[model samples]
Target: MRPDLCLENAGRRYGLRGPWVLRGVDLTVAPGRLVRVEGANGTGKSTLLRLLAGIDAPSEGRITGRPRTAYVPERFPPALPFTAVGYLTHLGTVHGLSRTAAARAAGEWLERLGAAAYADTPMARLSKGSSQKVAVAQALLAEPELLVLDEAWTGLDTDARAELERAVAERTAAGGSVVFVDHDPRRLAGLPDTTYAVRDGSLVPCDVAGPLPSGPHVTVEAQGPPDGRLPDDVRRTAASAEETGPGRYRLTVPAPHSDLLLRALLTSRPPWHVVRVAPRPDAPGSSR
Candidate 1:
């Protein structure tokens, strides 16, 4: 199979020589496959996307790919000005598109992303969701072989989100590739094949073969020895991971979203994993 992108032992540190945002990273994305990077704020998610897009050079390691890439960041740059249409038209012109052709491309992307009405508005003047839609449009305008979206869905509503998802799916179907970051995993549920967690200046695969790092502060202790493993849903949404007692585990989750976590626990379809949340904290020997 032909590999569309390859990074070997990649490391990046902004400035001449300082702290590194990404270190010892290795990844490969072939044609027709999607990989996601997931993490909390300030976890180098954007830095990683930049590295993938070749916007910046990696301090160490190597990247091999054709010049088929598009990058869409969370917020459009102030330099682009508030004129979203003009921004795209100018970008297209830089790529050697004539004014008329540039206007045509910009118009099509604006309509496709549902930001047609906001076409002439300056990007700085657009709302968060609208501005993000502009960024999406910018990335997809040229239809690069590889597209990188950084926080691409942060500002979109439900319908807008669905439209963007469909667009990406269709692109992949046509032999294009994409990589993007999403703050909310729920928004990304149907988007990526592999989700990566970024933390402590590192990027690692997440939501595969292990539990998520966040939990509702629930710990499990078997009366006897524990067996098998925890479910993927628990792992993906787990807040933190800590071993409490012997053969017992505790998962901390945001208190407000505790019920959603519990509901997921109860509704395991195959029924392989079962958690019992004790109704009262004071209750003896209760678990979920």
Candidate 2:
């Protein structure tokens, strides 16, 4: 089983006397959870993610539980001598896959991200969007237990962006953990199990789920285990959950969060049975 990645009161800085980039950070990336880190430019969002991915060591405190990890940085270097597929294949082998298996997985991810046409193109010759696709593919080719992404969607087109989201959902549903940073508030919207913000060189919990929009909401009816217990993530994501009968629940959540809530219920150990799903016409705006 994969262990939770933990950062306990961690701090980092450049030089011995340099100012701290991040400090007093305590975070735990648990299995099957999605975490979001938010901050303006130069607020150490990337630094924090680097710590989580083991790319950098903390200047103080400690980080423990290093799971099999992969990371996609904000900028991907495109000047490598190898072709896109070759680069990904090389990375796959480094992650412990055999040469044949690595090449096969490389091809699959490239095709899924709609970049198969550029498979043999030199890394430096590919377009920015195509290069970004290669970068995303390499991180996912290994099926890592911990995935860290820093603005991994910046250069992708609409279809590629949607494909990455689906990949993230699949990872978490398969009992992997993911942490990401994106500029768009709606990137994952209501899907994150927990959201944190970097403020004044510290990590702080923040409510990313702002006020409800004037759009329609979703109502899900599900039945939990025989003990009538729901997963913590399912309860946290729902706006309101009421028990109408034993082991049965009616959950109301914003439309954007419905998929995440359902994933939590259905992916639980014993799994929750969904009875029905319908849109709540409480809001007077367009459907989501």
Strongest candidate by lDDT: 2
Superposed Cα RMSD, model 1? 11.5
What lDDT tens digits, residue by residue, belong to model 1 across residues 178-259?
7878777654343355778888888788754333323223433212135435544544333443445443455554433344
lDDT of 2 by residue, 1-288 (tens): 678899999999999999999999999999988999999999999999999989999999999889999999999999999999999999999999999999999999999899999999999999999999999999999899999999999999988997888778767766889999999987776668799999989999986555434445798999876676867667656666778888898887766557888888888878999999999957433211
Looking at model 2, report the run of 10 residues with the lowest lDDT sum.
279-288
Model 1: how far residue 230 lies from native, Å: 34
lDDT score, candidate 1, position 98: 88
Those runs of model 1 whose alpha carbons end farther than 4 Å from true positions after fitting are: 1-3, 78-82, 96-98, 207-288
